[model samples]
Target: MMDSLEGEELCYPLLLNVSCRGLMRPRFEAILLYTLFSSITVLTVALNLMVIISISHFRQLHTPTNLLLLSLAVSDLLVGVVVMPVETVRFIETCWLLGDVMCALSYIIGFTLTSASVGNMVLISIDRFVAICYPLQYPNKITRSRIEVSVCLCWACSFLYNGLILKDHLRQPDRYNSCYGECMVVINYISGTVDLVFTFIGPCSIILILYIRVFIVAVSQARAMQSHITAAAARKVPVTAKKSERKAARTLGIVILVFLMSFCPYYYPSLAGQDISNDASSWAIVSWLLFFNSCLNPIIYAFFYPWFRKAIRFIVTLKILEQGSSQANIL
Candidate 1:
């Protein structure tokens, strides 16, 4: 019994030592990789937060899609704030130094936010498809109340789905630490597998299908509008309407492209059964790809919507001028 007690006492520190192994090396190449990843992660999260703050501070962005975007921004921000910092330190440490409780909490938060982000995207795609394909019906179909309901449902589903972690049967007599070093309890394999399938694989598949349908509808609508424009011109109809339709199509294309590019990198490895490793390069790349989603949201907005650029520019210039005036006053 004394030996067993001694063994239990050693487990915690031994785990820490194991987690920190090889982490202190200052290898230039490894540093470069992780540094690059960390920079991108920070940049992306920063952009996400900036956009969220800007929209909240100014009420002009209260549209349904923007509201959904806000939800996504919040989720991504949590990943950026709560998840990435710890993860990065673990990367540098080369181990899970924090223990089981932190590990469980991090995993739960990361997974939930990620689920919400992807889920919101899917909902947005569905919203866009309806707006583009059935403009007249869209107003009646997707009212503010409906949007709110959908958002609530999205969040509720996310919460309940992740809440299954409560049912996880794993007893961490040994403190849980993530591959990265945060102390958290690991869910047993069965629960973990179930959560992964339901949260990641299932929603991802649905999103993929929805986007595919959305693209098809968008392309068809674009072609139909073009033909209609040609006929309208033949009949001497106003050109402004046609111009608006063309612009909308282009914006949709850009949004779809950005979404695909940003998400594909993060999902591909997981779907492919690729091993995640402590190799600094792999961790760096994963970090970049994941946090990069947060950044791309605002960028996609700015690129696809002229109004977003105007909002961002106006906010940025106003801040700069305000800061300059404050400096002059101080001097």
Candidate 2:
């Protein structure tokens, strides 16, 4: 009985000397957590997959902005498919059973998806900035081909940047492990600081600045539309186009706000001049908050974008499988 009890406490009981401790959550709590996170994983994947199909299958939805949304959905889909499952096991089990190589790859995948998400947000903000601030020039400035190239660059840069940052971890997966059943990576102070600036601070600064400008321009345009003189003078302007731009700006604005809220806590340790430790007590909560952003994104789209609703209806009803459905007017 004592041996069994002791064995239960170790993640790898046969190698007790090198094993990390097993999590000891109450049965009820463990079940609840598993249910909750599993739902999130499923929802995130399904919702983002819907977004992917909606954008990709509909010819009418192939705008430059929607292409960026598609890129963002792909990154979110990866988070749901790859990062969330592994992270759920890591957090709930509180021990690594997947081996050192899997550990390194998980961290790399997580970082790459995160970086790509941030990159997509930056691109979306720039797209909105151009649309709102220079509506007349938006078409010429942002094209389908340009957006495609930019999306490719965003993903490629994410992979290259994260690989560079986590090169040591990749090469020596067990370098930071103190025991066989502990999966963790440690970033040195210098590299951590650089990552903080580049990944969080720099990107966030650009997002905030561009969004602030977008907000200012949108507000001014609203006020201008309300003015009789400005409205009459610009009567030749396409009101429908202006309304579309304003609506898109509002939807993307909410996305940026939610992203900022979800990610801020995850980086609080870095902001406070502390090394980011994956094993910290609050790490799981903050990390989940960040991951939860991926799930929330598709929900935001559903709530804000009418086309997404129509697409979901068509998708769920099997209408998308019909011939020539791709050319159906989704807008």
Candidate 3:
């Protein structure tokens, strides 16, 4: 009878182990995708950091817009640093080894930096729109103090809202939803729902509306410029400044397009939720795509800015010369 009881007791864990092992196929595929995605993201992040550092170190690129670009680069770099590393580890292993405390820290840091970056983008978009449309008032309206205050407010809001999650939660074992594995590590279903609304839906809606208004305003400005040029020619005046404004508008449009492309995949999975099958393969693909955003910014620069190519060339040359010198010294 004792031997019979032992056999029954062993059967339960054995069954569970087999079931969990069956789930491993999808998880293994996810690990491969995470590896590829994280590699690319890290490379892109490295390039962005170089660009930001080089620009700041070289005084020639010190325009207000470049300053904003620098800020965006910093935020993107932080996302790669604070969010992607832990996320990649979790996705690949299908577990969270960092415990609840670290997971909470990851949650807060990632949320705050990403939100701040998004907020800064909105502010920069408005600044560009105003600068192009109302050149006379732009200087007075967008002073250094005002920009600083706006940046501070963005940070403050990000911290307060993201920090709200940290208050009531810790890495306690009770909070772990073993069913979802690492997917439910940092947050539960209820908090995850809240995160989806606040982080993805709310911010995305505001950005979309703002960008729409910006596009409309840009169209109107173009029409006005065409009319102004016709009147200027009649009055025998030059229209050189309008041409410059048009070039800047084109650059801004490209930036907006890149931002949308990079962020869409990241938010799509959250919006899809359980409807998307919660299967490992689909989740892995979406997760990697989102992580791709950190790396996409560097690609954006290469596509849109000739200066970035020059910067890359400079970096390569420097590295080659440094390596050559090291070899000579070793010899």
Candidate 4:
């Protein structure tokens, strides 16, 4: 008979000597938590799928900005489809059932998606900065082809950079395992510090700087509009220009804010000069916090962007399946 401590059990009872222990929770609590997390995984996949289909299928929505959004949705969708399920299992079971190869692959996918997200955010910040601060030059500078190339470069760089960062773990997935049923990876201080600068601090700095400039320009334009309102009222002038810029600024600002919130907690250990360990209980919470951002992104779009709402309506009603639907004027 297998020995048990209280209600706890070994992950691999037959190989008890090499097995890692699993946390035992009450049956009701385990069921409830599983249901909750499964629901989030489903919702995240569905929301990002809507974004992907809306952007890809609709010809009218195929702008440079929307392309960038499509890229983001792809990363977010992978988070739901690939990362979240595995992570859910990891957190809930508290032991690794999958073999060593899978362990390394999971982390690679997670890091790649994360890096891609940051890259997409940076591209979006630049897009908005140019649109709001230099409206006239935006048309000439931000072309569809250029944006496509940039998105490809962003993804390619993310794959390359993360591969380099996790190269050793990929080479030896079982190196950090304490027993047969454990999955973990350790980054040395030097490697961790380098990753911190490139992946976290550097990209965040660029995003913040660009958005600040955008914000300043947006404020100045708002004030100018206020000043002109009285004078322009006599001439029946249109505030369309000011309204568009302000709206774009507001939407992107919310995106940046949410991104920061999702990412900061995950990196807190690094910022505090602590080694990131997957075995820590706090790791589960922080990892899920980061993953939850994917779910919130489509919610943000649904709330802020009218086109997304219209697209969702069409998608839900199956209007998108009709012939020549791509030409439908969603904008």
Candidate 5:
């Protein structure tokens, strides 16, 4: 009985000498953390799932930009479905119980999804810039086929890029673990900094620049429309089109701003090329913050869209399951 009790304290009982210790916190504290993380994981999956259903089920929700959003939702859904739960298990147990292959696969999947989401956001910003600044060319430049191709490229690049990031670890999954029952993949500060710049900072800067131009164009168009209301009825089509562009610009701008705010702190270490060691005391809390921010995304993104709201109503009322529901005029 004593041996069994002692073995429970270590992640691997038989290999006690080299095994990492489990979370030794008070039982209440451990339970609390587990419950909280579980809630976040479930909420993330539920919210992103709704987004995926809303976009995919509604024919009217299909657009170049919504397609990009659908891509993001898919990635974020996987983060919740695959990444968050894996992370939660790792965090609560404070041990890598799933073995070496899972450890490597989890990080690769997480990074790829995150990187792909950023890529989709960049594409969204470009789409808005063209739609608002050069309305005449929007349709030709941001066609359905082109957007589909871009999304495919974004995901493909993400998978390829993340694989390269962890190539060494992939080759030898146990390479960095200091002992049995431990799971770790190390990225030297230089490689991490390079990743930070390429995957995060560079993309954010591009998104900001594009959105700024979009905002300027949108504002000027708004003013011009305000001054020409006398003939608004005569030029209703162009005016409506411009108004829709402005609304999309404004709403997506807010979404991008929120994204920047929540994710900025997570990447702040990149500026100093700081190492992200799991052994750091702040790892649990800091990592937990990321999931908290994720839940806010569906709230902010969906709040701005009437079409999304309509789709939610359908989904909630179970009308979405009705035959021919996809033909509903959601817009």
Candidate 6:
């Protein structure tokens, strides 16, 4: 009876000696958690996929700003497709059945995509700052080729940076595993601090500074435009274009604010001088909160863009499949 009871708790009953113990949560609770996270994963993927399809299919949406948004959507999609399901299984099952290699790769991929997403946000801020601050130079400064190069560099740097951050874990995938079936990655306080600074503080600082400048310039421009635009000038289309740019800047501001809120809790341990561990008791809530940001980005950021609304209509109605849909007026 003792042997059978031990078997019930062990992840691998046959290899009892080295097998890790599993969670003792009731079956119903585990199922409920699984169902909930699965739904989130699906929603995140579906929403981000819509953004991708919308931007990619419509020629009018092929501007440099949308290209940055496209990069962000791709990263968020990977988070949903790769990171969310893996984490859900790791947390709910409390067993790392996929083995050591997968354990390492999963985190590497997750962190890289996350860093890339941050980089994309920074680029978006810079794009807006240029547009709002120097309207005449915006087109020349934020070109498609320049944004493309910047995006490629952002992703490449992310991969390299995260690889260094998780070098030890990648080198020895089972280094932190206490027993078989366990998956744990611990970032020592030193590494965690460095990560917090680069991944959170540094990038966020740049984004904050740029957006502040953008906001100041935007306000001045708004006031000037309002005072200077005569009824005859307002009747022309030029005034409307400037107003549209201001609206987009406001929308992206909300995206950055949500990004900060989602990220702050996950780094709280580091803030408190503790090493970051994936297996911590509080990890579930904070980590899922960060992942939940991926689901919210599309709704919060893209939903405000009128073109996205119109694109979704075309897509949902299958009108996007018709000939010359790629040339459709999305903006």
Candidate 4, residues 15-133, lDDT tens digits: the string is 97989777677789878888999999999999999999999898988889888888888998999999999998888776688999999999999989988977887888799889989
Identify the candidate with maximal lDDT: 6
Model 5: residues >4 Å from true position, as ranges?
1-8, 230-253, 291-293
Comparing 2 and 6 on lDDT, the stronger one: 6
Which scores better on lDDT, 1 or 2? 2
User: Clashing pairs in model 5?
Assistant: none
Q: Which tens-of-lDDT digit does each residue in 125-228 have in candidate 2?
A: 89988997999999999999999999999999999999998999999999878888988787767777788887888888888888788877776776565564
TM-score of every model versus the real structure: 0.70, 0.89, 0.67, 0.91, 0.87, 0.90
lDDT of each: 0.61, 0.85, 0.60, 0.84, 0.79, 0.87
Higher-scoring candidate on lDDT, 1 or 3: 1
lDDT of 5 by residue, 11-63 (tens): 78799689876646678987998898888889888888999999898888888
Stretches of candidate 4 exceeding 4 Å from the true structure: 1-4, 227-253, 301-303
Error of 6 at 121 (Å): 0.6
lDDT of 3 by residue, 53-160 (tens): 555644455556666667667777888877787767755654445655676676568668777777767777677667756779998988767777777788888899
Candidate order (TM-score): 4, 6, 2, 5, 1, 3
> Pairs clashing in candidate 3?
100-171
Q: Over all chains combined, what TM-score does candidate 3 have?
A: 0.67
lDDT of 4 at 266: 75
- Give the TM-score (vs. native) of candidate 5: 0.87
